[model samples]
Target chain A: MSKVYTGASMSLDGYIAGPGESGFDHLFEWYFNGDVEVPTASDMTFKLSRASADYLTGYISQTGSLVVGRRLFDLVKGWGGRHPLDRTVVVLTHSVPEGWAPADENFVFVTEGIEAAVAKAAEIAGDQVVGVNGGTIARQCLDAGLLDEVWVDLVPVLLGSGTPFFEQLGTAPVLLDGPVSIVPGDRVTHLRYEVRK
Target chain B: MSKVYTGASMSLDGYIAGPGESGFDHLFEWYFNGDVEVPTASDMTFKLSRASADYLTGYISQTGSLVVGRRLFDLVKGWGGRHPLDRTVVVLTHSVPEGWAPADENFVFVTEGIEAAVAKAAEIAGDQVVGVNGGTIARQCLDAGLLDEVWVDLVPVLLGSGTPFFEQLGTAPVLLDGPVSIVPGDRVTHLRYEVRK
Candidate 1:
């Protein structure tokens, strides 16, 4: 009953990132025209976080528990120690930081696989969809056939190469249920799709 | 007062196409879900064409002139002579195609400088926007500051690298009128941005 949603931006030719992730700055520089309409809630430091929040709220009103990868966790941590998620956030990783747990009340560092993490999140999420927020975790869910929906915000910039969010997928085709388009501003495009086996 | 509405997809770190364009397939693949509730009009091919039409029509709807790069012209020609734009299509190139004329007063070929072709397109489009369909010509317009607007439907796949759609561009920034997100099915996410400045 719980739907897993995967989302990210890609290139015109279908690449997630270029070699060593070069040219990202160039691409960002091209599309990095900051939104002129200022947000009423947050500053630019967590602009992406703010955007992601808008995305998460759309499907699952509130994620009882959220999960992320270690790298992504660290990135979020680096954002001036801002834990944007209001609910429990389980960082799925092997290594746990010394003082990371002290950062928040709902933050949990889990070494278990995505399934275990999702199971835990679902217990807390109840009837709501379990929000999977990391690239690796989302792909793992997709591979495991656990995701019920995918929301990709495909930004219109291409990085010649880098760490691809989604790579070689399973042979079996995944079907669509419904697709909708939303415009946050003239800069960001939101594409939501329901997944089917 | 031509507004350049630019559109393209980038990675999390922000790269348009990876070094060699290896990841473009994923981006294209995301758009296709065999099953979905979307109207047939929202098909991938139709949406791509419509976005181009919308951006072009926003400017020169009255004129039926199109300016594309030779590569695009060749690419389209290979598709069983299915020319999407049946107007005066000026293929901007040094090498002119032999016996290539206006396809029933709708498609015309031009092998020359971009300025002449676009100027002619402006004449033909009259109050309509000259629909620039190819990446090279689009980039040329961007570099020359001639493009009024660009409508980019950023897909959710990243090509680590490829022949960049905007390789000629430096670190120039464009204004985002904002973007709309269209998620069709589970894989494809379409984002359209209105070009400003």
Candidate 2:
């Protein structure tokens, strides 16, 4: 069995981006624009990088597969073909995308919906975790009762529009496991959450 | 001169509403869930209510009247009718809707450009500040450069889609005054922001 973790950064007004699929320039600018009182640059960079690295490595070490939606996949594919997670990547969609896997041998496109996607991802991830990689995908897993934890980097900008991390997730209360950490910055505030199963 | 305070709660991923425009029931739940730890019940209620009251009063104290968008007017016109700051209210829209204001003496209707509306509102407000209520109205003021300050309450919940508090404002960076308070909770978090000038 594997635990699923959904992680992403969002603006203050609940928009991942502004009206259109705007670039994250404003969001990132607000985050990195301020003078943080974190003591040293080495310490700051180490903490930020280590947290992301640990999150990524934790999943991979646990033999977790990556779950992403089509939009996210297209976005990443356009980012100079850089695939951050080098593992079994499961894409949630209806029909398999044309040339979705590209030349990446580690890609496994799952279009059978949220539950089946997680079951397959769990099978492949055995003894590890499943990294819920996008908002829609994560919410789908959550709505389908599969997600285990949700880690977030709470940015300070109020976007006021665009795609959200959790939309139309139906009506159900999610129990929080515990508080992991509160990484504060001049522009962004980070918090981690574990889902209580 | 009138000052506009922008306020709303947001999740770590920047979602204000989960999805659709079902009145953001999830957000209301998250907001009243009381995730943030306050010193005491009386203190907490007072602080929260006072904040809203202060914001409402601060603007109306200077502005003799208020101009709200249709959606906001519909949402809050009932209970807000008798709560303290009982003054003139105007609903702004492209085409005037039926029954725009509460059945009382102080409400008016404006169906024109923001510039005209504000000019008239200013006259009516006199020395008092014109309190612009709701997302559409706020954006109109922002676009017209009529806003002085914005106060946002960053609540934790990702409504995938709904009326954004800032959909049309684009991506201009606003100055963040400070993190006034950090209220924690399982289903929600509260953060306050003041617009820089």
**Every candidate's TM-score, chain A alone:** 0.70, 0.75
Docking class of 2: incorrect
lDDT of 2 at B5: 44
How well is each residue in B43-134 modelled by candidate 1, as lDDT tens digits? Answer: 22423333333433333334356677777667557233433434455567776566655333544555557677677677766655576753
Error of 2 at B152 (Å): 3.6
Residues A136-167 of candidate 1 have per-residue lDDT tens digits of 67767777878876665544443434444555
Q: Pick the candidate with the highest TM-score.
A: 2
Residues A35-73 of candidate 2: C-alpha lDDT, one tens digit per residue: 332222122322234344444344346646777787876
Off by over 4 Å in 1: A6-60, A78-82, A99-105, A152-175, A180-191, B1-63, B78-84, B98-112, B152-169, B179-192
TM-score of 1: 0.61
The CAPRI classification for model 1 reads as incorrect
Q: How high is the CA lDDT of each candidate model?
A: 0.51, 0.57
